[model samples]
Target: MNLKVIAFDADDTLFINEPYFEEAEKKFCVLLEDYLSHQGLSRELFTTQVNNLPLYGYGIKGYILSMIEAAIKVSNGTISVDFIKKITEYGKDLIEKPIELIDGVEETLQALHGKYKLVVATKGDLKDQQRKLHKSGLGNYFHHIEVMDDKQEINYQKLVKRLDIQPSEFMMIGNSLKSDVLPVLEIGGYAIHIPFHTTWEHERIDHKVEHQNFSAVEKIIDVLKILQ
Candidate 1:
C-alpha cells in the first residue's frame, strides 16, 4: 500500500487517556456512592455526557460538568457545595496530569517520522490537546498537527486537501472506529483501528463491520508493519 500522509490520534493511541478519565469517574462515583449505587451513577453520568456533547464538545471540562450534573440529579439538589468543588479539583488534576506514552509509541513514531508525512489529527479542546502533545515530548516527530473540532468525513476531506494528497494516499490511525476509522474510510482513505483498553460510550459502535480499506492492529508497534 502506498501512503503519503499518515494522521494519528492522540488520546489512547499515543498516550494514556481513557484510563485517567475512568479513574476520575470512579472517584466521582464514590462521591455519589451514598446518593445512589455506583453502577447507577455510572449509567446516569454516561447519559449526561452523551446529551451534553453538543454543548461541551469533548474534554475534562465537559466531563467535570457532566459528573456534577449527575451528582445533582442523583442527590436531588441536596449534594454539598464541597462535593462540587472536589469534582472540579478532579478535573483540574486530570488536565494537569502528565502524558504517559502508550507502550512503543515513541519508538513507533521515531521509526515512521521521516519515512512518511506524519501528523496528528486528534479531536479535543485545542488547548488541552496542544498541551498534551508538547508535554509528551513527541512534538518534534510530526510534520503538522491538527486539533480537529470533529473527525467526520468533511474534516478528513479538508485535511487531505491541505496535505495535497489524494484520498488513497492518506491514512488515519486511531482507537475509536467512530471517530477515526469510518470517517476516513468514507472519504476513500485507508484507516487503522487500534482499540484501547477502555472506550467512552459515545465512541462505541453497534456492530463489528469490515471494509477493504479498514484494518486493525494490536498495538502502536504493529503500525510499522502496516506502513511497510
Candidate 2:
C-alpha cells in the first residue's frame, strides 16, 4: 500500500516484439544479398553488421538507416534506391502489425489501476513503441508513458524526478536485468523483474543483484499477490 507509482517496461515486458524484428531481419538479409552481390558482400558479413546495429540502440529509424549505410558501403555506392525503400517499408510493417500482449498484463494493470499510479517506461524506436502502446489498449491504464532513448543510471534518476516520486515509493517492473533492474536499483528504487521467455542474445548479460529492494518473478500476475 505504500507504493505511489508502478512503472512498467513495454516490448518484452508487456508484449511480444522480438519476433517481429527477427522476421524483418530475414527480409532485410535477402535484400542485402540481392543488391550487394557485385561488391562481394557475403550474407555472413551482412548478418554481423545487422545484428550489431543494436549497439547504436533500438529504434526502427536508426536500424534502417544503419542498414542502408552499410549496404551502400559494401556496394561501393552502387546500391539501388529501391533496395533502401524496400527495407524501410519492411521496417514500417514490423511496427504497424498488432502486438501480442503478455498474458495477465491487462488484468494486473486493472487490479492496480486505482490503487497506485501507473506508467510505462520503455526504450526503443519512438514510433514503433508509441504505436504498440496505442494498440495494446492498456494505454488508458497508465497515467504517463515514457519512451526512453536509453535506460542508463541517469535515465532512471530523470524519471524519478520527472514523476516527483521518491525511490522507495516507486517500483519498476520489467524483464531485462541490465536495463530494467540495475539502473533502478542503483538509484535506490525498488524493482520486480519478470524474465521474458526468450530474449535477444545481444541483450543478454549477467546482473549481480544484492539489493533487498529488488525481487524477480516468473510472471506478471504474481505481482498482485505482493501488492494486494
Candidate 3:
C-alpha cells in the first residue's frame, strides 16, 4: 500500500450535513407545498418533482430552483414573485451555514495529512462545496479538492491520471460504497469504505462482496493502521 494520493468524500463522510439539510429541507418543502396548494397544485406532484431533480444535478439551490420552476409551470404563472425571492434567500442561507465536521475528522485528517497527498473528492454545488471547505478549516490539509457533478468511472479515472498516480498507489477513503468504493476498485485503485452510522439516503451505496480492492471499517480513525 504505497499510497501517494488519498482522496476523501465530503458531506457525511467528514461532517454532519444531513442534519443541516434535514432542517432546511423541511422548511423548504413546507413553503413549496404551501405555495403550490394556494395555486391549486398537488403537493404530491410537487414533492415527486423536487425529489427527482437530483437527476438534473446535486445542488440544493438547483433543487429549490427546479422546484420553483415546477411550481411556476404547475401554477400557470400563479407563483408570486415574492415567494421566489423568499425561497432564493432561504436557499442561500442553507448553502452558507457553517458546517459541522464529523467526530474525529480533524484528528484523523491531521494524522494522514503529511503522510499522503490528501484530496477531497466530493459531489455538490461548486459554490456551496467551496464555501463549506473554506469554513471547515480542513481546507489547508488538502492539495486538491474536487467537487464533481457526478461520481463515475470516467471522473474517478481522470482524477487518478491527472494526479499522476498509478491505481495501486492511490487510495480513496470514503463513506460511500457506490461512489467511492466501487469506482475506485474498478480502476484498480485501493478503496477503504468507512461506513457512517447514519448514511444519508442520497449517499447510500450498495456493496458487493466480490470486489478485491474494497474493504470496510467501523471508524475513520482506524485508517491509520492501513496506511502504516
Candidate 4:
C-alpha cells in the first residue's frame, strides 16, 4: 500500500475508554434501581443518549445530561436535586479518569511516527479528546489531530481534502468498525481494525466487514506486520 498518512481513532483505539463509561453507567443504573430494573434503566439511558446525539453531540457532558434526563423520566420528575448533583459528579469523574494507554500503543506509534504523517482522526468533544491525548503522552507522535463531530463517509472525504492527500493514500486505524473502518474504507482509504475488549453498544456493527483495503487485527502492534 502506498499510504502517506496514518490516522488513529482516539478513544479505545489508543487507550482505555469504554470500560470506564460502562462502570459509570452501572452506577447510574444503581442510582435509579428503585424506579426500574437495571436492564430497563440501561435501555432508557441508551435511548436518551442516542436521541440527544444530534443536539448535544458526543462526550461526558452530554452523557451527564442524558443520565439526568433518564433519571427524571424514570422518576416521573420527582428525582431529587442531590441525585442530579451525583449524576453530574459521575461525568466529572469520567472526564478526569486517568488515561491508560493500550498495550503496544507507544511502540506502534514510535515505529511509524517518522515514516508517515500520523494524525488522530477521532469523534468526540475536541477539548476532551485533546485532554486525553495530552494525558496519554502520545501527542508528539501525531502531525495533526482531527476531532470530528462524527465519523462518516463525508467526514473522511473532508479529512482527506484537508490533508491534501488522495483517498487511496490515507489509512485509518481504530477499534470501532462503524466509525473507524467502514467510513474510511467507503471513501477509498485503507483501514485497520484493532478491536478492543469492550465496545460501546452504539458503535457495534451487526455485519462483518469485507473490503480489499480493510484488515482486522488482534492488536495494535500487529499493524506493523502489514505496514512493514
Instruction: Judging by TM-score, tell me the better candidate of 1 and 4.
Output: 4
Q: What is the TM-score of each candidate against the true structure?
A: 0.95, 0.85, 0.83, 0.99
C-alpha lDDT of all candidate models, in order:
0.91, 0.80, 0.76, 0.95
What residue pairs are clashing in model 2? none
Tens digits of per-residue lDDT, candidate 1, 78-139, equal 98999999999999999999889999999999899889999999987889999999999999
What would the per-residue lDDT of candidate 2 be over residues 1-228, giving only the tens digit for each residue? 367999999988899887776677667667777654523443544455456655756776766666677677767788888987887898678767788999999999999999999999998877778788888888899999888878888998899899998877889999888888888888888899998877766566875677888888889999898888
Judge candidate 4 at residue 38 and give its lDDT: 99
What's the count of clashing pairs in each model shown?
Answer: 0, 0, 0, 0
Whole-model alpha-carbon lDDT for candidate 1: 0.91
| Candidates by TM-score, descending order | 4, 1, 2, 3
Residues 1-228 of candidate 3 have per-residue lDDT tens digits of 677999999987887666665565556556667554533443443454446655656767766676566657665788788877876776777777778887888999999888889999998888888888888888999999898877788889889898988888888888888888888888888999887766555566465646767778778888877776
Ordered from best to worst lDDT, the candidate numbers read: 4, 1, 2, 3
